[model samples]
Target: MVFCIRRAYRSEQAGFRAGKFLTNPTKAGRGHVNNLRYRSSTRKKVSLLLMLRSSARILLLSQAASSSFITSSSPVSRLQSAQFRTSARTMSEMTPVFTKDACPPAGPYSQAIKANGQIFVSGQIPADVNGNLIEGNIGQKTEQCCKNIAAVLEAAGSSIQKTVKVNIFLTNMADFAEMNETYAKWFAHKPARSCVAVAQLPKGVPVEIEAIALQ
Candidate 1:
């Protein structure tokens, strides 16, 4: 009896290792073990297929997110695009105005700049075309400054009559009456104007003038 029990125990161990079991040790029992093995193999294959499908879904989602990031219309990006367009348009429209009929600029700046349907004249002191300070009283000095502005406007395809704004700088308010007298002769259309007194002006002149005129 001991020998027969040991033999049966060894047979059971060998069956387990081979993916089979001997419950009844008959033909029907062997067929049931084969059915169990088939079910286990089917489950493993189904599990592998599910895992592959899940990985593919994850990869597709990642690719879609990357594509969305490339075409993102965030606020900062939109603002940057707008600013670049504005800068490019402004640069293309801007053009410098120069003429020997006007006083030469005393510094590293254009005598006038034309852009956006307007001409912007730089501050003009009482100077001649050669950049020499003119010899005159306050009224004459103001007239000379207006003449320089007119020349710049003409060069830029604008005119003093089309001036939309004028900015006047004076070293003394006492000369306002004289300056206004000469200014009215030039800007008779009564464009927008602002006059202010400063400590001094360029080239030691008592007055400086600048203007903006429509093209």
Candidate 2:
């Protein structure tokens, strides 16, 4: 059972060759078509095995042009349907951290930056909410730095116990012992750390400390 398009069977009549209409004795309108197809009113599939008494190529063309069916053997046609699909793994987004309870940043930066399930607290000094350097000994100033870092981490949804790394800047190497004593009490977990003696710190403070903590 099959469908058929009744183009004057090109193979039956050798005289009816491919594109024979192009050699018409007399030309017609610009959009004139060689409408050589017909169909049966009934929806039943008709096997035109009798009508297709010709070459395989002619039968192939007839089946394609027929209105009742579709063929999908051409590579060019199938290639047009090919698509490039790539699944891209997306991760959670990051954001900045801020807290009015902590000393405001003295420069053009946020107190912390939260990213990839972690929070990075910026370097903090012994300054009050008013941005004034707290007048005290090295131990007191170190405590203040820890306090500020704690506040910033709390606002960023983290804490000192979760701190993974710490970087400290000291104006005087002799103050390292005093800063460590204060820093130790704040971080009982003893997170990784590095301290260096710089020529000076922000606002001429004795110490500055920054930290990275897990969320």
Candidate 3:
């Protein structure tokens, strides 16, 4: 558009200079010469306005095309699309872990969910595979909880050795020592752990344990 405008301006100036030479001042009166100059000035003004309008239209079309390209091909737009696809794939790849070897889930939840090369085991109380609560002290209860976690990990193709984090909930803080005694024997790798005294546990159990492990 700019090139077109420059060309038109240059041609108009050249025509104006040529008109001076083309018209013979000696063959006409002063009034006749002024009238001819007025007509020439009017023609050039009209031509310039037409050229400017054409340039404006061309500029608008070029801007519209550029905006359309940016909307469809910008980096931010492409990145957002890729992230959405990755999230959907991760959600679809998640696999629920369940086994007859471990105690059944007491509520409407999976025993464990395996996703992104990790196992997320739900909290396990001191119960057998039949969902029967085990009768024993805190140490025995802790042992049963660890056993159930081991079973769930095995079902998900993971193991106690790979356990990365453990959470232990107890109804009484005094039971911490006994629970640690049994817990240390199971988690020899000494993964990160948190033990908190809660007001109560499901089925009135003294302790419950949950774990996370890398597959």
* Per-residue lDDT of candidate 2, residues 96-149 (tens digit): 898987889898999999876789899999988778888889999999999999
Overlapping backbone residue pairs in candidate 3 total 0
TM-score of decoy 3 = 0.72
Residue 205 of model 1 has an lDDT of 92
Flag clash pairs in model 3.
none
| Candidate 3 per-residue lDDT over residues 99-205, each given as its tens digit | 99999999999999999889999999999999999898889989999999999999899899999999999999998888899999999999999989899899999
The all-Cα superposition gives candidate 1 an RMSD in Å to the true structure of 12.1
Q: How accurate is candidate 1 locally (lDDT)?
A: 0.84
Q: Identify the runs in model 1 with alpha carbons over 4 angstroms from their true place.
A: 1-80
How do the candidates rank by lDDT, highest first?
Answer: 3, 1, 2
Candidates ranked by TM-score, best first? 3, 1, 2
In order of appearance, the predictions have TM-scores of 0.66, 0.58, 0.72
Candidates 1 and 3 compared: the better one by lDDT is: 3
List residue ranges in candidate 3 displaced over 4 A: 1-73
Q: Which lDDT values do the candidates have, in the order given?
A: 0.84, 0.75, 0.88
Query: What TM-score, to 2 decimals, does candidate 2 have?
Result: 0.58
Task: Give the per-residue Cα lDDT of candidate 2 at 72.
Answer: 54
